[model samples]
Target: MAKAPVAGGYYPPVGFHFKVEFVGIGNDNDIRFQSVAGLTVEYDTESFKEGGENRFEHKLPLRTKYPDLSLKRGMLTDSKVIKWCLDALQNREFKPAQINVILLNEEHQPLKTWNVYNAWPKKWSVSDLNAQDNSIVIETLELSYNYFTVN
Candidate 1:
């Protein structure tokens, strides 16, 4: 019997290819984004020093802070995300939405997923347009979320 060659070590997935999904929001069916950024999680540490402690410091976890998430994409004609931000500004009604960021492998399969909970748009900005530059108009949406989990 002939022996087949063994496969080498595994390669890490690329970071550029990913998908974002918006859930628990009305009129979010057409919310296709180009890029998602600002996925960060951090913790605050508290240091305590005892009266008779030799030279060691006690470090404790104080609180966890999740930074605001930002999404960027080309400006669409419908502009559902812009509308949502306007609704929150004008009507003062902020609706929580679940945002999922999925990283896909080369075969287009989901490799990792991050679920953001209770997210609402905090700010929105549009890119500047210039006739000299031939670039598509891009829009950025910043979101403030309570917490997020990785799966």
Candidate 2:
């Protein structure tokens, strides 16, 4: 028997620094975000029972669920993100946008990419102000997407 090759002195990529881009309708140009979170995909399983089956159970794939994506950054004067959210809230016919989350390597190059399809802003919020504490105003945008793909 032959043994499998083992990797030596290899380190995995860190997830600290990354960039996000919003593409498609409502956003003519690609918009970059400061930070991204809640990028996840999950699926439900459907189990079946057989009459003459052994102790083992059979399972099948079910519906897939994509969780909402949350983006946060320091408050900016730009109104693009806000406008998109407002349009969806006010306009009767709103268009979905494509979002891209790019993971970067230590050299600031893209290591992995995640594409979010048919995404629309679901919620928008801003951080509260404090009288004594000194902190930059932060804005958060939450989005709902049909599905996401990793590449």
Candidate 3:
């Protein structure tokens, strides 16, 4: 995402300066995300043709479809967000929650926000272990959300 302009001709906030929150989860680890992806929506369209004309087909817009959301962070031994995801995926008990991705300025003030609604974990995975390469193990959590609002 490109940085948006700020007041007083201030430069745009860097992408690395941001915060993520899983609303009401009450976990410190939940807010520290290394990366967030898949905050996008596209309209589903249908094409219609008239019997009498040979012109281009009319395009009709349908409901909006949101792609799955992905959050990544360093591996943790314990996390409430992980437990919630496990309960839904492992125990077949699904519970949805809201997620907020906030882009912050130099002062850590929110420049823009994306509120994801009714998000439930769809897939969880950890990075591959390779002794040859030295890197922190990252855990990725994928979720399917109904929709997101930008502000």
lDDT of 2 by residue, 33-149 (tens): 667887787778888988899897788889899889998878667566677777887774467888888898867889999999998888878899999979888888898889989
- The TM-score measured for candidate 2 stands at 0.80
Clashing pairs for predicted structure model 2, backbone only: none
- What is the Cα-based TM-score of model 3? 0.87
For candidate 3, what is the total of clashing residue pairs?
A: 0
| TM-score against native, each model | 0.84, 0.80, 0.87
Q: Write the per-residue lDDT of candidate 1 for residues 1-151, one digit (tens) a residue.
A: 6445546855667888887877644354344678787788888999999899978989999899998898888877675657777788678889878888889887778899999999998988889989999999988889999999899
Which has the better lDDT: candidate 1, or candidate 2? Answer: 1
Off by over 4 Å in 2: 1-7, 24-34, 52-57
Question: Model 1, residue 85: displacement in angstroms?
Answer: 2.3
Off by over 4 Å in 3: 1-10, 51-55
Task: Please give the lDDT score at residue 95 for candidate 3.
Answer: 89
Specify the highest-lDDT model's number: 3
Q: Give the winner by lDDT: 2 or 3.
A: 3
Query: Lowest summed-lDDT stretch of 10 residues in model 2?
Result: 24-33
What ranking of all candidate models by lDDT puts the best one first? 3, 1, 2
